[model samples]
Target: MIPPKGKPLSDFPSLPPGFRFGTSTAAYQIEGAATEDGRGPSIWDEFCARPGTIADGSSGAVAADHYHRYAEDVALLKGLGAHGYRLSVAWPRVQPAGEGTPNPKGLDFYDRLLDALVEAGIEPMVTLYHWDLPQALEERGGWLDRATAERFAEYAGHVAARLGDRVAHWVPVNEPNVTALLGYALTAMAPARGLSFDALPAVHHQLLGHGLTVQSLRASGAASIGTATNHTPVWPASDDPADHEAAAFYDLLWNRLVADPILLGAYPDGFAELMPGPVADDLKIIASPLDFYGANYYNPTAIQAPGKPSAPATATAAGHVEVPSDLPFQFAPMTGHPRTDFGWPVVPEGLYELIMQLRERYPSMPPLYITEQGCAYNTPPDADGVVDDSARVAYYDAHLREVARAIADGADVRAYYAWSLLDNFEWAEGLTQRFGLVWTDYETLRRTPKRSYHWFAELIAAQRA
Candidate 1:
């Protein structure tokens, strides 16, 4: 259960020394100026242009105006007492066509942002790509083509050459599985293709891109490199054998498929045969050792055999990826847990379970970071201009306790980055979901620090003390 609002930080479990606190934001989701300063269009730009594709028929063309107001956002981060900030570099922005000469103005934007972050004494964790594939690349078959992965390595080299000196940590890709599954197989996100399981090529190419990016960053003098993959504990709907099998498959696809290649240097038996290219050679690159492993967790998922009566009507019925009925598995709602505004189950213990599972599953796993963890609560600023999002405060409180618990059990957890620092464009959901500690007025692009923001600032202060 969520603790009541105003609960003191002293009541929560203590974190170990050097446990960093930070916040994460994606480029397409927050950094607007889609077509500004020679910026080429991304697949999302085209995706949002399609009628009825986005929930609110909204586009991120001017999202939060972060491109113009990053300094203001940096001030908020400093005020929040964040030790580090994780931000993604827009691929199209750096290379408008995802290739050829890098755009000077585009690189200048990040140069200024990183400068501000360093000046404020905050460490910068830069993710090389966050699903904003250049439209030019997508037109050339995107991740489905091996050339795209090669292009990504080139792109990574360009960014590292310019900013490697400033970025303390490098994440090559943000949630590659989600990109392949949602955008390629499910057709629910950008560059929608609805290729179903046939999207396996996209998966292989993305992992290859990640491995290649890691090499590029290292060659450019990147000292710290890691991943930010979304993970969930898959629960079977019932005791039936079919349900158990389906759950195992979903777990393998959602969790192990991306991780085993990186951590174990091998795919879960026989799966490598499905990928294109020289599987053995690519796995060698994909398995490059990392300095740390980042897990982006929200909640546990329940899975059941396809065609079950209890299955959700659509894959995204639970506000996640869409699952076609023809698939071997289906999504089921978890019961008895509080639900976020996005309808994701609030199973804080899932975070603990995932950390421990990672430790046991891959003994050689590097230190872990909770790169993204937060709930969506669209609590508007009440009349006095104060946004009191107590539910979100409680959510963080409960989750942080689990992080502490994992540490007590000997997980080498290093950091916790809230999902975002400000409410911004939410992709297909547009501005419909608010996951930020700072509430954003879309109409005015003004940021108001919510009650949870102050609560977290105090938590960070108390931790440092």
Candidate 2:
């Protein structure tokens, strides 16, 4: 690797062949214009309105304005040499009230998007939902109600009937586990704003919705379908029995909770024993035949075994994993190392180990995709209207090398899509957090790719060469 003028470029390694490279953006994150073109209010729209919901006090009400500037974004995708583009279709935008006849306006937006991908020689990998549940659905109990799952299937069908003609790659639901846990179980950063609820219903219903949607898409002649799940490595704090047991519990909740049921046709041993009620029947639907499995991995959690000389742990500011005081395993916060703007620990090695575990655990699982892996950094602007964003550049450099290392060790990895194409309205944190290659002036929504974008393009050129 060539070192730059004054500083050394990251010493991270390069990628392997047949490993795809792409960029990802969600519907709610980018495609703003909340109430435009007859689009209805998403749960995010309502969430952003609630006091203290978003950090920057801004809503996707008029985000990157991708709805208006998507042409430029697609052109940006082509310029970046993206092999594929992973984007989500807004549930609210497409189905308006989340029921009945589809909204022609919402479908039209995707119609142009898919067309743009085809024209640009980029594969359009679509995510059906990325946490932007229509407010209309929430008004009817959202995922908590089994009817929401049926509605998802119906909505999926409407989408497939239109875009399915050209778009082959499909991810039924992006991080349903997170959608349930964050939206329902933990806190309301999303739809059905609530905390610590009977989320099992939402969980099962979401998975069932995936199965039903996959079936619908499959029937529509769509060739590819999968789901993106977020996983974290749980490390035991010590050898003490308390620590080991606590680590196991955390593992059941964070890592295995979703994959075990879908890939193994059952939850982890202790997990099923802990579930709320008789929802075993839903597993049948959740365990649909997926074409691939996309996992969104960031950092691993250290278990910090109890009753031993406890090692220092890093606390996630996002409060991603909830550890109770009485619980044996407390989140050992990772610190010291340079962190992203979001304060997530910057550890690439965790990603390497994560892939190995997936290989060991679910050998029968489908081909894996690094669904979402990118960091938010303090994206500062330069004099020439550009953001140097070197922190983000390093994050991707290290992570990509880990990705390459995993592929060398025999993981059926197909692709890597950066977390975003452009920074838009970050939920909860709102516009304060920037997790994108392209920087957008919130007011003007002018897209400007940071240094990372150039670095990625150079890497792609080198990868191809």
Candidate 3:
């Protein structure tokens, strides 16, 4: 049974000894200063410029200003008692055009951030790419072109060589499935292409790039390497056979399409034939062994066969990507559960189910890391400046308990990183979705730690004790 909401942290099961806890943030989401210090424009920069793309019509130009305020952010992490901090290196910032000479300023910025993290006794996990492709590469066909994968490998090598020694863990890519599905197929994210099923090449190219990146980081003597893939449990809307088939297909596309290549070294049936380039040879590179696997879990999805006349309109109204009428499946709402501000269901047990399913599917899978898991709640400070975000605190409480339950059942879970440390630019949705433990005033640039932050700090202290 799922644990009751808002249970005291002390009531939750103890996490395994040596388990690590941290917070996560992507570069473009937090490190504003889009044009500062030789940082080249990323596809997101162009995507946001287009009218009607972002809900709030805002860009990450000055997003939390982490580029100029790394010291302060580090202190926030330190105060939160985070054992690790997962951050992404902006590719455009490192190699402005996604190729050619490295940017010293970009490397130096991470250099200083790492120094601060090291001084604060926080291990750093650096993700090489988080969907911020340099506009130059997007103009060259981006992930759809195999050449872009080659460019990604080169860029990975440069960043790994520069900061690999300082980073405790390296994640080559963040949510490739989302990158391919939303950005290319659905046109819901940056570099929105709306290519539909033709976007399969982007998926193959991303996996190939991930494989090459693992090789690059290893060559640079990186310590630990993994990936952050968003995973969800696919539930059929009903017991109908058609619904089951549609859910299975959605699962293959959203979960196994990404996992099978990395964990098993072979695409699921029907996928290899659709991919670009030499498939058999590429599988070998795509299946490189990893030190761990990062699972970014939020909520499970309910799917049904297409042709529900109201499905498309209902999903679009709820801020979901519109299900193309031609697609085999459509998303059905998972009713009877609490939802976050972003409209994601609060199903803590889904995390446990996902881990067990993965374990059963891949016997040789690597250790697991709960890489990115948090909710979005608009909890601004009150008159006294206290941010009472009890819902977020309850979200974390329930989710962490689920992780413990998974661990008890012999899942090799290692670490857990909250989705974000500070509220910053949420891509596509813009600044509207706040998923941070600390609230950020976009106008004043001031941060006020919410109630969840204090609760998390206490939970960490209890775990250590």
Candidate 4:
């Protein structure tokens, strides 16, 4: 890994031809006109209202005001010199009830935004959903109900029909595993945070939605289609058989759970039995083929053997994976690595390891992209409107070099987009954390690109040159 110091783009490693560098943001996280332009309230709008749901007691009510300041945001995108911008469609804004006629105003907002992005010299990469389900859908069992899959196709059709003309790259869903685990098994931190063994259906239906959506988009002439998943390496902590078994279980859930279906067109063996329902039919839809794969990687996991007969999951609030408590391999904090403020390990080499595994395993693996890569540092602003967020800058510099290294190693790593363009409403943590290279003055709805912005801009320019 490159040393933890802010490095300019010229100092970074070389990338291949047509390798595009970009930045990403989401609807609910940045566009804060909660009630603007006929947009309906999302599950997050209500979720944040319930006291203690968000750490800062803040909601996306008036986030970065991207709704009104989008022109300025696009200008910032131009200055960053990124070729693409990834953002999500607010399901509520598109279809407030999750199944109905399209919301014209909501649709218009995106039309204008996409046009603005193109005007500013940026290609738009749209993610159909980013965990912000329309509240109406959650009322109808959300992802848990198989109907949600059908509704998602309708929504995808609406998006594709309008923007699909210019928008070629589409991600059906962002982090389906995180949506199922965090929103279901892991304590309902998101909308429909229903923690029941029954939530297994939610996982199946979500993947089904991804598969069906891909089919729908393919039929519509989408040249490229894929989904984003978060992955990490699982290591057995000891030589014991139990720990080995435990590590295998962790790998199945974290890695294969989402990938096997898209690549192999089936679920991992025995995964169906662990799931709640008889998924014979659902598996058919779950294992849909795709043109590419996107992985949102952060850190690796160490697992010991299992104490219990079943392989328990580790989606609880403690950040602990349930392995055999007294077995050979045990989950522990990342060693020999620095941790982020959220206590996530900052291991850039893990990114290299992740890319290599994908290449060696999936023979049909599509071009890999780092969909979301950035860190949260408490970067407070100064009077000059500039955030000297050197920590975040350093974090990104180290990660980007590893990305180039992966490209050099035949990983087919095509693009690297920073997690965000501006600080807005971070889920669970709310506005308490900042992950953007540009600082958002929530009070004024003003955006100031940080030093990392200029550094990355120069880097992108140099890489392209």
Over the stretch 342-461, how does candidate 1's per-residue lDDT look in tens digits?
877788899999999999998889999988988899999988999999999989998898999999999999999998899988877888999999999999999999999999999999
Displacement of residue 129 (Cα, Å) in model 2 is 1.1
Mind giving the per-residue lDDT tens digits that candidate 3 earns over 80-199? Answer: 999999999999999999999899999999999998999999999999889899999999999999999899999998887888778999999899999998899988887899999999
TM-score versus the correct structure, for each prediction: 0.98, 0.91, 0.97, 0.91
Backbone clash count for every predicted candidate, in the order shown: 1, 11, 0, 8
* Total clashing pairs in model 1: 1
| Residue-wise C-alpha lDDT for candidate 4, range 338-411, written one tens digit per residue | 76666666777888888889888887888888888777776777786677877777888887778888878778
Model 2 bad stretches (over 4 Å)? 1-16, 192-197, 238-240, 270-280, 304-329
What are the per-residue Cα lDDT tens digits for candidate 2 across 79-176?
A: 99999999999988888899999889889999999998899999989899888888888999888888888899999999998998778589988887
TM-score result, candidate 2: 0.91
Each prediction's RMSD to truth: 1.4, 3.2, 1.8, 3.5
- TM-score of candidate 1 against the unseen true structure: 0.98
Q: After superposition, how far is residue 180 of candidate 2 from its true place, in Å?
A: 1.8
- For model 2, the local distance difference test gives 0.78
TM-score of 4: 0.91
Residue 252, candidate 3: C-alpha displacement in angstroms: 0.4
